[model samples]
Target chain A: MKVKAYITLKEGVLDPQGKAVEHALLSLGFQGVSGVRVGKYITFDIQVRSEAQARDQVEKMCQKLLANTTIESYQFEIIQS
Target chain B: MKFGVVIFPGSNCDRDCVHVAQTVSGNKVESLWHKETSLPRLDCLIIPGGFSYGDYLRPGAIAHFSPIMPEVKAFAERGGLVLGICNGFQILVETGLLPGALMRNVSLKFICDRVTLEIENNKLPFTCRYPAHSLVSMPIAHMEGNYFADSETLKRIEDNNQVVFRYHGDNPNGSLHSIAGVCNEKGNVLGMMPHPERVAETLLGGQDGRLLFESII
Candidate 1:
């Protein structure tokens, strides 16, 4: 199995990098963009037999390594590979 | 007093920390490799700044699982004095030795310059040489120095006075409460973004940074 973890700054957390991206887009004449937030996308291969097992393992990975619970939140999708 | 400065694979400031801790502060110092499973009895441990493990995944993420961290965590749990500067601060938070996490700077640029820091609490073992609210200049060099925590942790720290140092003038990295440094609830472990090791000698510049090492000694 494979999993994709999307890690992002939690709501109400300051996203300076995201803000800078938003400003850069505005200066470049990008229109109708209300906000811009930046996050990380990571995928990993897991040797799990079932989707439930992959999800469980990925959740632990996200909590322990992929995401920092103090400042960021994450979600993952277990794709049957 | 004796000190040990942990040296991660990519650590660049370990030598500077040695100079400050040994030559400047006149304390015995040793370099502890990151893979070491044991530590010598020492009064203080300094985790200096650098891109440990090339900051893969996130700053300090990989280093948290290094061989030495188990001992470091045990030392911290026993109230051993630990000071994490710049990249070291990132590692400390990542290892759960401290709360909060360092995020990318608000400007999305690597910052390397001297910034004024206000000593929020001089009562800490690490800051007692400086008077409360005293402003001192130190160099901060890092891209991910902005600090963030959940509302509950922020509130708890605010009430507990865990903040040890804060930016004096304009908020440099967009850290909450202009925080440049903080300590754990027990106040034994300190993590700060600024590099006091770089400014600890008069030949380099003013000796304001020496006060921190001096106080610890």
Candidate 2:
């Protein structure tokens, strides 16, 4: 099975890179851009038999290595296709 | 006394840290690679600054999961002294061994310059040589050096006297309370944004950073 994890800074945490991108877009004549927040998307190819097992393993991966729970949150979904 | 400096693949300041530790402390310092799962017995362990793992995903994000971190955790839990400087500070935060996070500089640029730091709490082993509130000049080189935490957590850290060093004169990175360094609850572990190793010698224009190493020894 394949899983994808979306990791992002928690709400209220400053995202300077995203803010810079927003500014650059506005500078280039793009308007109505209110805000931008950058995130990371990570995909994993794993060999798991059951949905429950996949969820457990993915959660463990996030907690142990994929994300820093102090400032960021991560969610993962198994891709059936 | 023996000292060990953990060297991640991308760690650039490991040599500077080793040099300072060896010179100032007169102790044998070993450079421990990130792949190693065990560390030799030592009085101190340093996580030096650098773009660890290329600072991908996040600063200190990938390096935090290195095989040696488990041993680092165990060493700290056993009351061993651990000091994380700059990128090392980020890794400590990622490892959940320290609170708060280091965000990008408010100026939106990588800052590399000398700044004054007021020693907030000299009670910890890392700063014991300095008098409380003493100002020391050191260089801070990083893009993600802004430190942030919620008000409640900040209050707790303040109450516990964990806030060790605060930027003086002017804040460089917009860190909350101008905090440049902090210690864990036990005070044996320290994580700070400034590079003490860089300013450890007078020939480097200042020796203010030497006291930090001298204190630990």
Candidate 3:
């Protein structure tokens, strides 16, 4: 099973890197582009028998280590490939 | 007081802390490797500054899962005094042993320089040598040293008098209200981004940093 986790800073939290990227984009002539919040994409393989089990395990990993719950939120997808 | 300094794979300031503890304060200090599962008896534990685990993912985010962190958490929960300096502070917050997270410097750059710090409260074992509201200069070297917490947690920490140090004159990192350091609710643990151990001797240009270690002693 392939699991992917997308981690992002929560709302109302300042994202300096994302802001910097947004500025660079504006400088490059991209217009009307806003809310450029940058996030992380992590992919890993799990040996779970079922997709549900893989999702459960990856969710646990995200909550425990992949993402900091205090300032970041995470969502994941389990792909049976 | 006897001290132990945790050494992660990428920790670069562990010796600086050991020097302050062993030579400056004349206390026994030991280096506890991250893979170790047990710690000897210690009065104080220091997580020194440096780019632990190369600051990957985020400062202290990866290092907190080291093999020794569980033991460190247990020790802190037992009320043992824990002092996290710089990268160490990041680890402490990541471990949930301290309130708030350290955000990137508002300038989005790695800042390294000497800056004045206001002693918000001197009642702590770490700051008892300085009079309250007094000022001291210390070196700060970090890209992510801005202290941030939700407004509610900020209010609680402020109401509980957990804030121990604030930036004086220059807010180098745009930390929340210029916060440089804070302690746990019980005041047994402290995490700060500045490197006090770096300026502990006159040879380093100032002895202000020595007082903090002496106070702990």
Candidate 4:
């Protein structure tokens, strides 16, 4: 199975990189853009027999390594390889 | 006082820390590798700054799980003095040795310059040499130096007087409450974003940072 994870800053956490991108877009005449936030997308192969097992393993990985928890939150999808 | 400086693969300031430790304490300093399973006798442990593990995923995220980290945790649990600077501060937070996380600077750029820091709680073992609210200039060089924590955690840290230093004048990295350095509840472990090792000698333009090392000695 292959698992994909999306890691992002928490709701109240400031995203300076995202803010800079937003400003650049505005300067380029891209309008109606707001609340632009940046995040990371990662994919990795996992050897698991079931979707439940993959989810469980991915959750632990996210908690331990993929996300800082204090500032970032993460979610993942388990896809058949 | 004996000192130990942990050298991660990408740690660039380990030598500077060792030099400062030896200069201030006039004692032998040991360099502990990230793969080492044991630590020699030491009174203070310094985690110097650099892009450990190339700051992959996040600063200090990957480096915190090195083989030597368990021993580092054990040493801190035994009430050993541990000081984390810059990238080291990021590692300490990742290891849960300290609170909060270091995020990207609000400027969205790497900042490397001297900024004034006010000694928030000089009573800490890390800052005992400085007087209350004294302002000292030190160089801060990092991209992910902004500190963040939930309101409840911030309140508890503030109430416990765990904040050891604060940025004076302008808020450089948008850290909450302008915090530049903080200590654990027990006040034995300290994590700060400034590079005290860089400014520890007069020949380097200032000796303000030497006071921190002197305090530990």
Among all candidates shown, the one with the greatest DockQ: 4
Tell me the tens digit of each residue's lDDT in model 4 across B170-216.
99999999999889999999999998888999999899999999999
Better of 1 and 2 by DockQ: 1
Question: Which residue runs of candidate 3 sit more than 4 Å off their true CA positions?
Answer: none
Please identify model 2 stretches exceeding 4 Å from their true place: A27-31
* TM-score leaderboard ranking: 4, 3, 1, 2
Candidate number achieving the greatest TM-score relative to the actual structure: 4
Q: Which structure is stronger by lDDT: 1 or 3?
A: 3
**B141 Cα displacement, candidate 4 (Å):** 0.7
Per residue, candidate 2 scores C-alpha lDDT tens digits across B26-72 of 87899999999888888899999999999997899899889999999
lDDT tens digits by residue: candidate 1, A1-81: 777889998887888778878888988999876567799999878897788888888888889999998888898887786
**Superposing all C-alpha atoms, what RMSD in Å does each candidate have to the true structure?**
1.4, 1.8, 1.1, 0.9
Poorest 10 consecutive residues by lDDT, candidate 1 chain B: B19-28
Between which residue pairs do clashes occur in model 2? none
Using alpha carbons, what is the TM-score of model 2? 0.93
Tens digits of per-residue lDDT for model 2 on A33-58?
A: 96688888999788878888999999
Off by over 4 Å in 1: A26-30
By DockQ, is 2 or 3 better? 3
User: How does candidate 4 fare on TM-score?
Assistant: 0.98
Residues B91-205 of candidate 1 have per-residue lDDT tens digits of: 9999988889899988788998899999988998999989879999999999999888877898998789899999998888888889899999999999999999888878898
Off by over 4 Å in 4: none
* Deviation in Å, model 2, residue B92 alpha carbon: 1.2
